[model samples]
Target chain A: MDFALEVNKLCKAYKDTAFKLQNVSFNIPKGSIVGFVGKNGAGKSTTINAVLNILHKDSGEVAFFGKAMTDDAKYIRNDIGVVFDTVHFSGELTPKKLERVMKDIYENWDGALFLAYLERFHIPADKKIKTFSRGMTMKLSISSALSHKAKLLILDEATAGLDPVVREEILDLLLEFVENEENSILMSSHISSDLEKVADYIIFIDNGKIILSEKKDTLIYEYGIARMKQSDFDTLDKSEYLSARKRGLQLEVLIENKKQFTRAHPDIVTDNATIDEILPMLTKEESK
Target chain B: MKGLIRNDFYNVEGSMKLTMLAFIIIMIVLGIAGIYFPPNSYLASAVIGGTLGAFGALSGTAMQKDGASKWSRFELTMPISRSDVMKARYISFILYILIGLVMAIISALYFMR
Candidate 1:
């Protein structure tokens, strides 16, 4: 498979501070929405910055479309479109004026498309961006990013503050982009539901290490929250499981292998896993 | 990169135009004030440039705040490179600064001459 973004042993640190990423490696196949998930300060932002060359990594490799991401990166950038949590449009200009400015910057910039998005998203072209609400500004940001026909879309907390309706719409639009099979997305968001909806793959990180990275559906099925009797838990092997929590004499186990464990211990009741459940269980206290 | 520059340019929105207009108005006001209550041309020029320069100097720095924000991660997902985003911003800054400088020069030259 042609990988859209390849990260290998990517590492970075802030002077004397703890390492931001530790030997993190993953491959995002072309035309895939890889959900980059981790809690706040889990180095999700740091990893994305290293991919974009925004911050210099202490050690590692990031490649986009098979091209090495380097500090001297130039032409490779035009292929990506970024939409962040905040749209910092200069308070000095209007979107109308920006259209003119952007046309010169993007070789494939589509004016008609940008204006169409503005209209669709209800963003006023002549109004000052400072007057826009958070949602409006984010729409404007996404409009500009999409209008340029970039091959990859990178989002960091872009939907954090957006209402669920708007967030879903944005996610739908991203799915539309990747439907063509040439476009891919590496969306970093704390809003797990958004990623759960559209992402094909997921990489969970905590304290600078990749705790779990797998196909979304596979993860949801493989890692299960198992509810069992207090007596049932006494004989189960702890090696293949993530954790166990006791509630009112009932025990719940988060295991990596549900079918095999179930086969061996047929009486143990298993519950379905969710994208949300996998992260905490897999990385919970670095489950032994 | 052009798209990003344009996006970032638009993203920062009203502050740029409002600030530019405010600068031009101040320069013109000072220019006209000098004509009636005439001060030294050099001092008048100094006052006009100084006020406008205060905001102008902040253009580069203001945009960098986003780079240090959550949006910096958003920017990475796009096909654009980091340096290109910065370059587009740098160009936009130069363009706006030039526009402001010209407006001041034209206003000052009109009165000083």
Candidate 2:
């Protein structure tokens, strides 16, 4: 399958800080929504910065649409729309005036689509952006991102501060974007529930390392947590579980195939593992 | 590139007007000074020239503001190349210098006469 984005062995480090993106790699297949899930300092933004070339990488290969990214990769950028956690628009200009600015910047900009989004979001065209509320500003950013005929969207905490209703609207918009089957999205969000709602695949990053990258449905459905007493857990093969944690007298084991594990051992109770539950377990150190 | 330039223009619109108003006010004061003190008439032209030159600084100031503001981050995410951004800054500065030089020349001629 043709991938929309591919990153291989990407690495970066800061002289002032100990944090580094350690050999980060992932792929976004065409027509897929990939949710980049990580804690705040889990190198999500660093990985994105390296991909976007906003920050120089120590070593790695990043390809967008099968083309290697170079200094003159402006052509690739036109097809990509990005929304950062902080929405940035000129405070002095109204959304109407900002459209004039965007029209000249993007070759495939759709003015009518932009205006329609603004109207749908109830964002006044004439009001200066400085006066807009946080939710309104976020909506405006989303409108701009959709206005351009973007094939891929790279959003970093784009829905962080918005209320649930607004997030639902944005989620619906993202769902619509991927309906064309020629588009993809790499959205890094803190809200796992939102990712659960829209993402087809999930990538978990922690301490500059990618802990897990798998199909969301597979991760949530096929994989499960096997809870058992320490004496009962001792008899099971260690290789069968990805990782396990000892909670008091019980052991919570992360099994790769919950169904198979349950079939093999009918007595042990295996529960569905959520992205949220799996994330922390993966990051936690192994128990002796 | 044009879009970036246009955005910059809109951002600096109010500042540009304020700078021009300051220049005009300074010229008026210099002209009145020239009328009262004939020996300082040449000095009036110098001050007027200096005021127009000061207006040239506004473009750089505007560019600096744009870079410092949150807007810079968003602009970098756009499809435009880094060279396009550089070109936009260059165009805005060039326009600023040209306008300043023209105003200074006109003021110098009027004051000298």
Candidate 3:
């Protein structure tokens, strides 16, 4: 019941583009990692920007630790750490210089911890950020975010474009971060396998709307994909499946509960759904 | 706010050093030229004017770098308010102008002698 972050009815629109975030809402429970999964341009970044007040929302309420984010509540941001797809610090700055910068910005900045992380991650302390490779830069970003002693981390594709080994390292760091029971993470990434490995909850966004928000286990274990003939599909009730698609006279239906669906139709078979399969299946068009 | 101003200065530090180097070189050349041509002694004044102009542009360069790297957007996520960010920029701009004024004054004093 205790939530680290709560977003409600968040809406944002751009005059130059047709894309807009529509009634986007989610909650990150305390000590839980919530994976925000969406295709590119699906309003994930826009929603994150709105939450951080980088983009003005048309209508919304975003709360951190039960305190609404308002002009007077700007101090709440000190407890939140953010890492975007690219390193936001200037290329001219070295990690050593960045420490001085961050120390002044964050009230809880841990200089020794920052140095330890840099050493552990094998990031050079004196090299300019421009000289770092993509993986090294990402590692540096994560190190900075963690060193701030932030209670909540909002990472927008932080692990993206890195090699599998580096991604695994970052995931391990995240798992370690949430072990404190006072920390949480909201990571928006297109990679579902990463979410499958670490996320407790998954929120799927598509075309500026949130289509699915559920426990990762429920999605993976209870949700099922049923393949059957047209005659067999007609016997099933509409409530049994979320969406259905027709392929060469056979129908593939996305069922919400695999056990119940099988019990209801003893002959029909259902396969467990992964986050990757569930996303497209949920958004797939119903067979005509 | 201190952090923001410090970052702005860091962003422009390279260009600031280059500008100072150019100012020193120009001031030396023009100072010698002024000593030789007493009647047409406007060479030092030209160097002073050019050096001060370059210093004024350093703040703009800092802002341009922030824009290019999207640091402007990233900083919004920090604990500072929007007005705090603007105030830091203005303060840094004033500091830049003050540094230029000091250099100009030193050049002017040197040329008078």
Candidate 4:
């Protein structure tokens, strides 16, 4: 596969905390949007930080378009755009002044496009960023990220606090960005619905490890939640389901293949699984 | 590196202007005092030295602002190397020093006359 970004066995450890990223690895294929879903402190931000070299990794290889980050960072970084959960620019800077700062840093910065984006988002060019609300700050960050002719965009919870209307607009912009087939996005967001709207693949991380990585369509269409009695659960093999939970006399099981499960057990009912439903099922411990 | 230096300059520009304005006012007051009272001419030199010291601290303030705003982390995502970042900062510091020196020299010459 032609990948825009590749992470191999990435590891990082914090001195102050027991938290560590253990053998973390993922890939962002060209022309695709990958959703990174995990609860708080699940190493989503840590992985993104390591990938961008913001936080140094203890060991691993991060490559951008087949070029190693350590060896070709100066050249490769120009092709990547990153937006954190919070806006990183100085509060004193207006969008207009920020353009000047960015144009100098990015070789391919488009000042006209940046101004147009601000206008499109209804952001005043001359107003200081500190005065703007959280949503406006987020829009500014997205505008800056897009203005740079980047091939790969890494966004960490970029849509968390925005209203649905603005979130939809940002999702549409992301959809437009990847239309070229050469561009890709790795967005880590808590909002699974946003990911469901735009993601091609979903990678679920838990406790600093990737628990599940699969195609969004496959996850939604093939995965199923089965509610079965204790007698029926005991009759089934452990391999049949991914995880199981018990409520009263009934057992809720997460099955990997909805069609296959239904075919095998005609008497049991299996409902389609969404990312939201699957996340809790997969992350929580199975009832003994 | 040029871009990084420009950013540092922008970050400190407002405070730098205010500092320079105060620096000029102090130099002017010292210059006038030195002319009327030659015995206190040494005070002008002290003020000039003090102003330069403040300029040095102003350079550090830019870095402090960056750290406070978490801009340093964001800066790493750019193409610039770590060495380049430090070099840009030192260059900004040197520029601030040069500006202070020039103003001091002008004030010194004017007071000497």
Instruction: For each candidate in the order shown, give its overall lDDT on alpha carbons.
Output: 0.76, 0.87, 0.89, 0.88
**What are the clash counts of all predictions, listed in order?**
32, 0, 0, 0
Q: Candidate 2 or 4, higher TM-score?
A: 4
Candidate 2 at A244: error in angstroms?
2.2
My TM-score estimates for the predictions, one after another, are 0.81, 0.93, 0.96, 0.94
- lDDT (C-alpha) at residue A138 in model 2: 91
The lDDT ranking, best first, is 3, 4, 2, 1
Off by over 4 Å in 1: A246-249, A286-288, B1-113
Any residue pairs clashing in model 2, and if so which? Answer: none
Error of 3 at A64 (Å): 0.5
Residue-level lDDT of model 4, residues B31-73, one tens digit each, is 6766677734676678668778878887888988788767888
lDDT by residue for model 4 (A57-149), tens: 999998899988972368678888888888788876788888998888898999999999999999999987778998999899999989989
In model 2, the Cα lDDT at residue A63 comes to 94
Model 3 alpha-carbon miss at residue A241, Å: 0.2
Any idea what lDDT model 1 has? 0.76
Stronger candidate by TM-score (1 vs 3): 3
Residue pairs clashing in model 4 are none
Where does model 4 sit among the CAPRI classes? medium
Off by over 4 Å in 3: B39-41
Best by the lDDT measure: 3
lDDT tens digits by residue: candidate 2, A1-288: 488899999999989999988889999999999999988799998898789887788999999999887658888888888888875887878899999999998889999999999999999999988789889999999899988999889999999989999999999999999998989999998899999999999999999999999999998889999999887888899788888888888889898899899988899999999988888778886664
Top of the candidates by DockQ = 3
- lDDT at A282 for candidate 4? 81
Name the weakest run of 10 consecutive residues (lDDT summed) in model 1 chain B.
Answer: B69-78
